[model samples]
Target: MISGAHVILYSQDAEADRAFIRDVLAFPGVDAGGGWLIFKLPPAEVAVHPTDGPPQHEFFLMCDDLDTQLGEFRAQGVEVTRPVSEQRWGKLTAIRLPSGAELPLYEPLHPIAHSL
Candidate 1:
C-alpha cells in the first residue's frame, strides 16, 4: 500500500535552503531531529517516460498561473534563474535556491495526473 513519497533536494547549503522552503515557500514541515526539517509537498504523481540514455530522476513544482506565481516569488526576492519558456507540455521556468541550485516550475498545458 502506497502512502506518500518523500523527495530530497541535495543542497550545497542545506540550512539556507531549508529556511527558504520554510519561510519563503511556506511549506509546513516537521522537525525530524535537531533542526532536521522534513517538508510536506503537495499532492504528487509519478510517471515513467522512455529515455534512450541512462535513467535519471527529475522534480518540478506545478502551478496554475505561471505569471502570478513568478510575481509572488519575485516579491519575496527569489531569483528567477531561468526565464519562462513555452514548452509543448507547459510554460516552464526555474528558481534559484539559496544553495545556488535551480528548481524547475511549470504551469502544465497538458492534463495533470496529480488531480486524479
Candidate 2:
C-alpha cells in the first residue's frame, strides 16, 4: 500500500535553497524540524532507460520557457548546460547539480503525423 512520497534535496544553506524554491519555482515548504523545509511536489514517474557506471536518478519537468529557465539558473550561479542537438526520441538541454551531476531537460518532438 504505497502512499504519498517526496524527494529531499540536502543543501549546505537550507534557507537559501528554500528561498530559491519559493522565489523561483514557488513551491512553499513545511518546516519539518531543525529548519528543514519540505515542499509538495507532483508524483514522479520513472522513465525507463538503460544505464551503468553508478547510476543516478534523473528527473524531467515540463517547461514552455526553457530559455528563461536557463537564464534564471545561470543568474543564481548555477552552471547551466547545453546539449548539442535533439535526439531521435526527444529534444533536451541540461543543468548541473550542486553535486556536479548533469540534470537533463527534455521536450518531446512528435513525428510528422502529430504536427498536422
Candidate 3:
C-alpha cells in the first residue's frame, strides 16, 4: 500500500537546517533518538519536468497567501532570497535555510490536487 512520502534535504549543516525546519518553520516532528528528526509535511503534490541534462527534483512548500507567509517568516528572522513573482501557476519566492540552501515557496493559482 502506498502510504505517505518522506522527503530528505541534504544539508551542509544538518543540525542547523534541522533546527530551522523544526523551530523556525514550526513543523511538528518526532526525534528518532540521538537527535535525529523526521518532519511531517503538509499535503504534497509532485510534477516532473523534462530536461536535456540529468534529471533532478525540486521541492516547494505551498501556502494560501504568499505575502502573509513571507511576513511571518520575516518576523521570525528568516531571510527571503527571492521576492514574490507571478507565474502562470502561482506566486513564488524562496527562503534561505540556515545551511544557505534556498527552499522555494508558493501559493497556487491553479486548482490544487492534494485531495485528489
Error of 2 at 56 (Å): 2.8
Per-prediction tally of clashes? 0, 0, 0
Give candidates' CA RMSD values in order.
Answer: 0.7, 5.3, 1.0
lDDT of 2 by residue, 11-108 (tens): 56556657666665677668889876788764344455678777776566545456677777778786767753577856678776545555566555
What pairs collide in candidate 3? none
* Candidate 1, 18-80: lDDT as tens digits: 999999989999999999999999878887999999999999999999999999999999999
On residues 3-114, what C-alpha lDDT tens digit does candidate 3 reach at each position? Answer: 9898999999999999999998889999999999999888888887789999888899999999999999999999999989999999999999999999999999999999
Model 1 error, position 112 (Å): 1.2
Best by lDDT: 1
* Runs with alpha carbons beyond 4 Å of true place in candidate 3: none
Model 3: weakest 10-residue lDDT segment is 41-50
TM-score of 1: 0.97
- How many clashes (backbone atoms < 3 Å, residues ≥3 apart in a chain or on different chains) does model 2 have? 0
Candidates by lDDT, descending order: 1, 3, 2
TM-score of each: 0.97, 0.60, 0.95
Score residue 67 of candidate 3 by CA lDDT: 97
Better of 1 and 2 by TM-score: 1
Deviation of model 1 at 47, angstroms = 1.8
